[model samples]
Target chain A: MEEQEKPTKVVDARGSFCPGPLMELIKAYKSAKTNDVISLYSTDTGTKKDAAAWINKSGNQLIGVFDREGYYEIVMKKTK
Target chain B: MVTNILILGDGAAGTIMANKLRFLTHREDAEITVIGNSKYHYFKPDGIHIPLGIKNYRDSVKNPKFLFNYGINYVRDSVTRIDVDNRNVSTQSGKNYTYDYLVIATGDRLVPEEIENFDREAHHFYTLEGSLELKEKLSGFNGGKIVIGPSSIPYQCPPAPYEFAFQLDRYLRRRGIRDKTELHYIFPLNRVFTMENVSNYVQKLFDEKDIIYHTLFNLESIDAQKKTVSSLEGEDQKYDFLILVPPHKGQQVITESGLAGDQGYIAVDRHHLNYGDYDNVFVVGDATDLPISKAGATAHFQSEYLSGRIASEISGFVAEELYDGSVACTTVTGDEKAFTLYFSYTRPPRALFQSKADYLLKWTSADTYFSGMLRGVM
Candidate 1:
């Protein structure tokens, strides 16, 4: 396992469905400063792809998507 | 010994079933074909956001050809008829396709002409064109009595009209004209929702929003010239703007084929989803005459169960899963808050109170709907 950097903000969106995790990520991204890392946890099966697509579209940096127990954590860095 | 499976309508139910069936019988010699009227499939739920200016019409549409994986034939043509006895379907383009198994997922049709003067007077939000037209109309309006409700029962998405009212209120407040606008919701039923608990909860929300609720107001006719809607019991209500949920019927092909029930919907076993006397025929989605809300969630649940049943029939395995008509819907109130209603045939619907998290879930479900459900991945 690689050593993961601590996130400046963490949005716990587990147990929420599709847009929930993605929306929370967007909200966190909006409030985050440049180079600030944010992590989102979600149980929705579609969030992994949605978050990745959103990150690419918004010109943010995707650090990694880690699959946790019964959920997934997506980390991103605010580049703009 | 090759089996030809034909599915009608490339909407949520048809699209999901096609992908699921293809996923299940990949190694087999079965042929899967989907007949749809349009090349693009629109997410019907997103239509609700159009009138409120939350989304554009183009964003809600997806090309069905790109959504389906390999080995599934997609035909973009209007269906003329279904010959159940011969197990064949004819398209308007003078082509006939024979099928060993048929799945009718054509969904429902909105008929505004059923109500007097509705076509000429009242506006609706059920169609893409209608939603856009309403969006344009709402942008110019300032204030007055805005009456919104279903013209009949069994309309698609039971909570939509209420959501429209809530969103409209939010829109009016944003424009600083809420005080001048009088909002009212008319329903044919006595309650705000189908379930008792959900109805009570929604009614309370309506009270909080200051939206007047009128129950048992069955629409009899719309007087376009007078700009009033009259109920069956001789009550007339004037309106500056009317958003009507037009009467819905099964597709014309289903009704003309004589496969529809008395209500113009296909009758199938609620659990097995098989049409009577036709083991190879299955029905799902709003087209079925099931005692449940005609919603995309219900169709999604039905497709999941029906795909397994169809796969079992083809692979010689017994399908143990039964459909319970389970449906889940998110009701968006204004201010980025929403409630979720989950229910089934055997269970009463329960509504989760207003929460920003639920609103986020509803917003994110669009991704799941387009990618997971449409692609047969979830």
Candidate 2:
């Protein structure tokens, strides 16, 4: 397995549903500085797609999506 | 002079709105009047059980007269025209009424004719008549290729097709035809559901139960003569029993009045449920094009916020409370196990956990729907 990249901020939103994790990601993205690496942990099945959609739409860099034991983690970097 | 609050259609939204409005406003100040043709206020969700012989037709229905709160007016006539500019509506009975506020909760109109051969080959449980028809046929069915799916986007309930499939699996097993029957499900989307997690969870269940599913199989038309239904993707599936969720449009009056938006749905302010450019006009339920699942819970939630705002405005308070789209329901996976789905406009759903508690809740929801939710007390 490749070495994991540490993020500037980690947001855990495992208990929330589809939009909840996505909503939290947006909130974190808006306040972060340029080049700030952010990671989001979510249990929602749609967050992987929804967060990626938001990232692509907002012109950010997607690092990777890691499937953990019970939840998944999405890491992205602020590009603009 | 009494302020007239006219609510069109007596579906879950309209009836509850009228009742909630009645509670907040004094009868001397404003009179609530509902217009619809149906004498019975149907709990439509329970209609799905009809084909399985789990629910009686009468069990899914209630007299509108008994459901309405005292002092509210009931007009047992269909609305033929809505002249919103003049604030007047004309009914089929040649009667007209002027309103200070209008609520359009007419729900959806199933247009099965959208697909060729649908009228001849398909059986569904979305409507009372369709459910009864399917029940008679389904109960007599022994073994064959049973295909079930929605014919179009934005059908009645989001999780209904999946639930129907699981319930049918159990039903067939109980009837000793499990080994002989083949169950197939088709969805228009890329997955079995819109949400990724829920879709994955349901896909797992489908796999375990040996229920075959096809994603992105958009319905084209059915060739009843060939006993086959074609998809937009050039795929064809032969079937002995075809059950497709009826394609829908906005209610008749809504379409006639030019109030319905794309695909026969009303476009409204997502937060306030207000009709375009008309503050006094509101919409709720399956009628609105809010990009949310059309369920009774959605309409009921909208009613709570809508009635409060209308009442506040009428009382000169002018509250600024906005509604966050929230809808909740229980989807049964089998005979007595279900999972709860709850979400809002911005929040996604977390509904993968199945429990008997949720199943019991789903079972008793029909009773509470009429007594508590529709009664506007819960």
lDDT of each: 0.82, 0.84
- Docking category for candidate 2? incorrect
**Lowest-sum lDDT 10-residue window in model 1 chain B:** B187-196
Candidate 1 per-residue lDDT, tens place, B1-378, comes to: 678899998888888999988988854668899999765677777766888898767877787778886889999998899998898899999999999899999999888777778888788888888889999999999999999998877789888888888888898999899999999899765567656577788798899989998865668788878889987535689999999899888888887888875447887887789898888889988998776888888888888888888888788788588888788788888777898877776676653688999888876666788888877877
TM-score against truth, every candidate: 0.80, 0.82
Kindly report which residue stretches of model 2 are placed more than 4 angstroms away from their true locations once superposed.
A1-80
Tens digits of per-residue lDDT, candidate 2, B247-316, equal 8878777777888744568878888899889989999899987767888988888999999999898888
Tell me how candidate 2 scores on lDDT.
0.84
Q: Of the true interface contacts, what fraction does each candidate have?
A: 0.00, 0.00
- Measured with C-alpha atoms, the lDDT of residue B177 in candidate 1 is 90
